[model samples]
Target: MQLRIKPYNKNAFPLKALLIKGDSVRHWVSEIHALGLSLSEVDAYPVPGSSANTVFGCFVLLHSNKKLSDLRMHEQFQSVRDLLFIPSFSTLFPAMSEQELRKLFSSSKYFIHPETGLVELPEPIDWSELLIVPVEKCREIEKPQDAVFIPRNVDRFQIKAMPPEDALQEMEDQVFPKKKEFEDKPLNLFEKGKLLFYKLLFTGKEGKQGMFDGSDIKMPAWLSKLWPGFGGTWFDKMQEDFADLEERNKRKVDKLMEMLENDPEEALRYAIPIDPEGRGRGQIGNAALDFFTRRSNFSLFGTDGRSGSGYAVDLGDAMYDLQRQYIKTAEELKRKGDYEKAAFVYMKLLKNYVKAAETLEEGHKYNEAASIYLKHANNKTKAAQCYEKGNMTMEAIELYKELEANEKVGDLYLTINHRKEANIYFEKVATAHIDCARFLKASIVYRSKMNDPEAAQSVLLKGWRAHRDGNNCLRCYFDNIADTKELGREINAIYKNDVSEANVDNFLDVIRHEYKKKNELAENIREIAYEIIAARSQSDPSIVVTLKNFNENDKELLKDAVRFKLNNKGK
Candidate 1:
């Protein structure tokens, strides 16, 4: 007899099942009875003969308000040969929009048949494929509640439940079964030596062994072999030894801390080992230094002098000591001909400018010394001196100019026989000083070294205009000239076109004064004097009265002047 089965509807029942199509329906009924679930507990539907051609059978556990993809399967049920499972759907489509649900059903590879109102796959699926609708597509369906499902207790029907003791035995057999007993292996020579070394290093009483624990202690393979077994006793002994050494170090640090409360400097001395031998046993010293240097609070000795706890030493004091040590180390490096290293320590660590510069200078490192002096010490003069000593003449000149030491700058140029450079600096000074002496020096340099008399004359001209006493400058110009006749001719040419009578008068006065100082011949002086008067008479007719007034002093001046005037007479 053939039984007609309708499509399963998830909304009509909480649980549903798909009947496996077989040769006889009685076989399936017996199998279901053999399992714990009864036929009434599940809503089973018969698979048509065409859909049951394969061994795989699909059973979908659906929820009214959830998607099949949302349900989580137990690990054991994740894959099965005959049972093709689909999870509940509420997690996939909880509160999904209506438009999204319509779009999902329209485009999904798995969809509910319109006629049957039942979900269907694209084709018949194998159980081993673990086929289900795609999670992403399922998430588009609209649902009101989260996806959930009651897991079936398949283990009760699939296999016999073992007793508690039998389960424990089975786990033990898989993980840690007993092994056959064997005799102990003998130790090799290297292993024996290692064991012996460890025993000797760790097994001794606290004060009995030498204080080599903190040093480069290692097990050597060449040591004599004297041990029997590698056991736990050695580790215990080593731990005890470490504890005792730690306690000793703690006591020493505490003692140093106490002394720091009273005499910090004395405590600092103990904190840094002085003797070479004491350096090897500096564990306590290092600890004490660290303890004081840190920011945490430390307890004092008793309540007599201090009641509250504070730092054993302030940061300032600690840094001061550290700086002193650094300076000492730098000095030692300097003494040992390690000047570069010493300078680094002085500059970077100690920040001692004087010492750093001195050390650099001692090593003939003048460039670095100049930099340190100029930048750190703010001593431009010293920096220039260093540059000069190093033969960095241009650098020294620049530095001297920065200091505005124009005289020193000129002197420096002169020392190097750089007369042109000297003249440059002298010109700057002359411009600043506006003195005849400075201009004279510049002119001398221009004449002697540069061999440019035109430049020298220009300098003199500038000096004459700059200085208040032009007469001194005029005398300097006269002294610079080689011939008195040429000097007279030059002076006549200079005053020939003088529009100002005062300027001509000043020129005459300068010539007269210069002549008086040298006691030059009267005729020579009269020649220059008459040339100026004759030129002045042409420009201004009033010079005759001045000439007459000048003739009153000497009768030779009048005769010579009359003859000079008559020689220049024209039609």
Candidate 2:
């Protein structure tokens, strides 16, 4: 069932229309169900004691007056429910002129491109000349069971005759109020219904006077019959009866919840036989248990007749309520400078040790926060940080050392102006890096952090000799060493006769490529590179040939090196 969805432009109309194949009956039913969910957005608000927050996905049937089900009466609500918000998050209505339908749902899906005239309708549709049929007859085309079955013809639909202009506008405004540029508008049907439904359904005031009271908004007769708030006639009486039943159920569930919290064995025993009132206490208790365990799928908007499910405990909503109260209490305590009480609420009640610690820290109770972090949160790093923040230098150092965070310990010692202690830990960090074969890291820490070039040189040379396969130490050694004579001697000793031809070639290539600038280090390295290349040429003549080829490619840079190589070609 390929359902082609066509969305109406807000300027023309604000509804989406789906054109589907005639044989796709299942998709039609599913779409209607989706639309029912959409209409429920009108009731979507944070309801007290109910955690099923609302999400909407609505659609309406056109020209069909039959109420599908008493539970699913939203289908017959299009005329009164003027504004429909679909799953696509766009507002739409059922009414549209034939021309508007043709312009949107035609064979060519293009129209005038916004800010450009690149795409448009092939020809201007003539609504007057074309044989206009009611939208009801659209199903009669090839497939009879489909909704909005548009054919290739562009002029098949004729707009359904509507109510008066002012009446329609008022209803539309009530359903989805238009926002004025500067003026504040009253809440619309969705907004009002959301708050009203939340209060009526979740606040345990089901059948109050103002409950289901939308006497101000005007709607059609059929809609008023199914709708609770519109006329307050038959549906209101039905709602009152449902409310009475629901209130009784709520009390029973509340008792069960209290029992479950205080006495688990008693709560389990409570799920027993029917009482004198003939109400199934067992069923109710089981439902509450399911809800307590967070396995309840019973939605308030459920069309199925599941009486006990609605009364089940909503743990999520209960948790949300507790959290909201915690926030309020925490804020009040903070204002009164009672941080210990606030932290207790976060730690003991909320089980949020991080938040508890944060609250203590915010109140300048850093030691208390650090203790909480260490004991409850089991966060050593945060404990160390809080200790440092509290000016507990010894405590911070101990935690950091336990965590093997030597750098942090060094930083803390420096904060206390203990240069000797700081350098000791910093050197430990450098040595640890070298032991891990992180020679470049060790050199950087020694040079940058420790401010000891000699120590940096010693580590780099150690790394180079231990891991000659790595080029980091070799590059760092040459890049830092300022003694040109010592640099040449080190280069000679490093790439000796016993070194593999590949390793010697790699060493010379590193010096030639890295030390290319016209500096004393570069010149000395290049001179040493020529000697290594000439010696390697004794075993492998291709070394000089490769250098000559490089000089041929770019004569300016490699000319001197290539000439030196050629003069000592066989040495």
Candidate 3:
């Protein structure tokens, strides 16, 4: 099938493409029955666990989802579990809309974009519990493909050499056994033959070789002569093999002994099991000698199911656990102020933690271990720094906030949010009036540039408030004073000092009343109002009555003073 895959911008599953044997359906099914063991190349996450990144191939499986066996489940899940974490780490995954996630989950047999960290959807047409089965299947796609299926069951595909329909027909045709069509008949019988013997075998040091030891059956001279000489003595190879086996056993024995040390009396219970739990072994190699000799008669410890498989023993975990506790004890000693012993203990612990954490990463428990290390990180600030250095921003941000480093918080916000993200952390910046002023200054500039007068006014008001709060970061005080004076002058120009004295006095009274409540240049502002309402003291009864009775906006009769002066000069 030709398939197209669209990956999530992120995800949290084992998304892989796999193709197996393609020719005979029988072989494919056989491999599938064997837990798909032949296709080891695509088990990818736990380092080639079960995922494929290439396209174009086929596979067959014996069990579908309805009949998935334990072994088959294991083969699929081992890798599936390991790579599942890859999806959670995706930044893009969370950025997807809900609709995208639904689409991705509905498909299979796709490319997982390394960049997007998404597993693509399966092809449109498919049958069987193929999705749930521990089956061997082929995923075939274009050249330069993102993923390819391994070649185990690939040769078993029924459609390998023909069109889909023809292959299907061929498959159906092959199912019906050939009946009386062939011409040959079968022959069945048994026969016995006589044995040929060898005569006279030699003896005596460097002179010759002898025949076989006492069993009764004999061979012919030609057959015996055809036997090739075995290189080196058989004893040498046997001894070497024994030595290797012994060494391995010794190591296991040592491990067993160490394990018993944790609880000697109950050691036997763990060391020996009647039914042979496969893990129950009395001895290991020389390493576990004491456990073997003293603990129980069962010499082999930790086996494939009965005896021990050395590679499978969790020595790394054990040593790590041991060292971890040791370090903890040492840390307690140190916390009690015993610097030297604590240091020693800590060193031991560090080694153990390292080992433990490596296992964690392999077991796909990386985030957990990282969480611990993140907690035990040198110090809050130091750990935060480490996380940042390690590009673990998510972790760093979380812990750093606990350190209560507002400055650091500010820095991180500035670096990442770029001011536009004031929506998230505006309060943090709002803490410092000076900072607020700075923000408002920029905001005011932006507002004015956008021709948003109301926004500009708000920003200016914030800036003014900031200045009032003793945040004189930008010398906005002087500009504010200048504006107030200019406004006062404009109001004064709108009126003149020609009103009746009564009016000036009355306006001053209003000014004085307001000044008691707010004194922001109020006294000076009162003088301007006084001038607007004033009446010049003159011995002119006619103009006084004219201005006093006229409205505040009437022209002063003496407003013609300039004209009168010009005429007098001509006279």
Candidates 1 and 2, the one with greater lDDT: 2
Instruction: Tell me the lDDT of model 3 at 376.
Output: 35
Superposed Cα deviation of residue 109, candidate 2 (Å): 99
Rank list by lDDT: 2, 1, 3
* Residues 340-376 of candidate 2: C-alpha lDDT, one tens digit per residue: 6566545544556788788978987666677667766
For candidate 2, the TM-score is 0.39
The global C-alpha lDDT for each of the candidates, from Candidate 1 onward, is 0.49, 0.51, 0.36
User: How much does candidate 3 score in TM-score?
Assistant: 0.20
Candidate 3 on 335-436: residue-level lDDT in tens?
455333233222222333333333323333334234334433334564456455545555556666787654455455454434443223434433342354
After superposing candidate 3, which stretches have Cα over 4 Å from the reference?
Answer: 1-373, 377-379, 389-391, 401-410, 413-423, 431-467, 470-474, 477-571
Error of 1 at 462 (Å): 4.6
User: Between candidates 1 and 2, which one is better according to TM-score?
Assistant: 2
Cα TM-score per model: 0.31, 0.39, 0.20
* Backbone clashes under 3 angstroms, per model: 10, 9, 60
Worst 10 residues of 1 by lDDT: 294-303
Model 2 residue 207 CA deviation in Å? 14
TM-score of decoy 1:
0.31
Assess candidate 2 and give its lDDT. Answer: 0.51
